[model samples]
Target: MGAEGGLRERKKLQTRAALADAALRLALEKGPDNVTVEEIAEAADVSVRTFFNYFPHKEHAILGRNPEHLERALDRMRTAPAEESPLTTMWFVVQDVLRDLESDGQLSRRGELIMSSPTLLYQLMMSSFDDERQLTAALAIRMGEPAGSVRTALIVSAAGAACRVAMDLHKNAPDRPVVELVREGFQLLAHGIDPAFDQRGIS
Candidate 1:
């Protein structure tokens, strides 16, 4: 039964991957404004309704595309032993994922496109905070803290800002490992450098 369940999950991931790829390809081919869910569905070889099952809307197909990345990251983080702090666990998981991506060369083209596309940049920002909330909430639970507590707030804020900094460095430090940057950013936050992060836009 576990094997069967794993197969089903794998199939779902494959379908989701196909849908996101189709949507991104179409958006690049034409323009983000002109593309529709129906168009992405056709490109993905899935029906429009089936597309909605995987994604709520077209803009989200690209912005919310990296679902697996976060899930896998958090899964590894959540397994840390009692000796490890939540922040430390999160740092390891984030760095591990970034290292894997760097090895696979998955960050260059797609991230470049998203950063350069003004429309997609707005969409990514809008969705990014909301996604951070979910991950932080899960980590908070593991930390035995109430949701949205001051501790959680600090961690989440630091994580969010650190992510923005790391992402902005994508174009400049294309050769550097994202994991190294992320790990260093988290270390800075952990070592009482929160106020030094220059929190202009982060709430």
Candidate 2:
């Protein structure tokens, strides 16, 4: 909380970001499974031991962006209007922030690679709970409720479901824009998913 603590956290964050960026580049240059921890550490300008200090394993380095992005979303959510519902603000802010990431066609290509690869897909989905925990805490404070309250639970559940739905839709229609998938996912969450399906079938 103090300046010293803040400095330490920021420095750690920088190291983590660097490590993930290096890993991503390596994965694209070669392949995710082909890239080694030492390679990523060297690319990050750190020793392999120091890499372990930031991430437990090579896969952790590959998946580290999820937590980093969630942290950014929390910072943005903290600035939401006080009068607005926390669930709504958090949802919109997260989507908006991720939309920026999705807009980068290159990064989305990385995402597509990760999603298509059977090994990374399972790990990414499994590790996503870490992000959900941070989101639940942020929403709880904003909603003036306990972290595990029904509202918080519902919001987290719905938001997570929407994200998965969007990803699945994106996988099916790789040519479609990510924003369109996200928009359609949110619409299904707002109304009934059945209606979206029915309309799509009619189209």
Candidate 3:
């Protein structure tokens, strides 16, 4: 029964990914506003009812209905080595996630589609806020801090900002490695941003 359940879950995930990929491709080929849920369903070879079962709307299809990547990151943190710090575990997970996104190629296309549509970009930002909240909670748990505490909130916010900067840099320098840029971004965070402080030998 457990094996059967696992197979069922995998099938559901595959279907969901197909719908999302179809939605993104159609949105990029046509405009987001021009693409309909029916078109996405047709492209994915799924019924409109099945599409609705996976996503509430077309925007959800493009942005994704769940935070599966964030969940995976949390799982990684949970299983990290005992000696590893929360930040170290975070960097490991971030690097892995960024590498996966870079390899997928769909992420770049999704970014382009979002950038072209103000509405989609706004929706993406709103969805990202929810993701940030989830990450903050997960980081807090990993660090043995109280969830929703100011310290964890600040740490998560800083890390998220650094990653965003790295992604922007990657967009401009597509030839460069995203993981390298992500590492550099975290290094800047660890080293402090102010040149004067570094000169003063502040740790």
lDDT of 2 at 98: 69
N/CA/C clash count, model 3: 0
Task: State the lDDT of candidate 2 residue by residue for 1-203, as single tens digits.
Answer: 69999999988978987887888778878888999999999999999999988887777777555455666778766777888765466568657656655543454555666776777777767766766677778777876887568777667667776765666667678887656676676666667556535555557
TM-score winner, 1 or 3: 3
| TM-scores of the models, in the order given | 0.73, 0.70, 0.80
The segments of candidate 1 whose C-alpha lies over 4 angstroms from its true place after superposition are: 1-4, 64-79, 95-105, 192-203
What candidate 2 gets wrong by more than 4 Å, as runs, is 1-18, 64-68, 75-79, 96-105, 194-203
lDDT of model 1 at residue 176? 58
What lDDT tens digits, residue by residue, belong to model 3 across residues 41-146? 9999999999998888899897654556778877886788878866677687677766655654666566556666887877867776777688778777777888
Candidate No. with top TM-score: 3
Global fold similarity of model 3 (TM-score): 0.80
> How well is each residue in 1-203 modelled by candidate 1, as lDDT tens digits?
99999999998877887787777777778877789998889988889998888887887785435566678756765777879877777677666655544543445545656776788878777776776677777778778888767887677667766766776676688775555566678888788875667677686
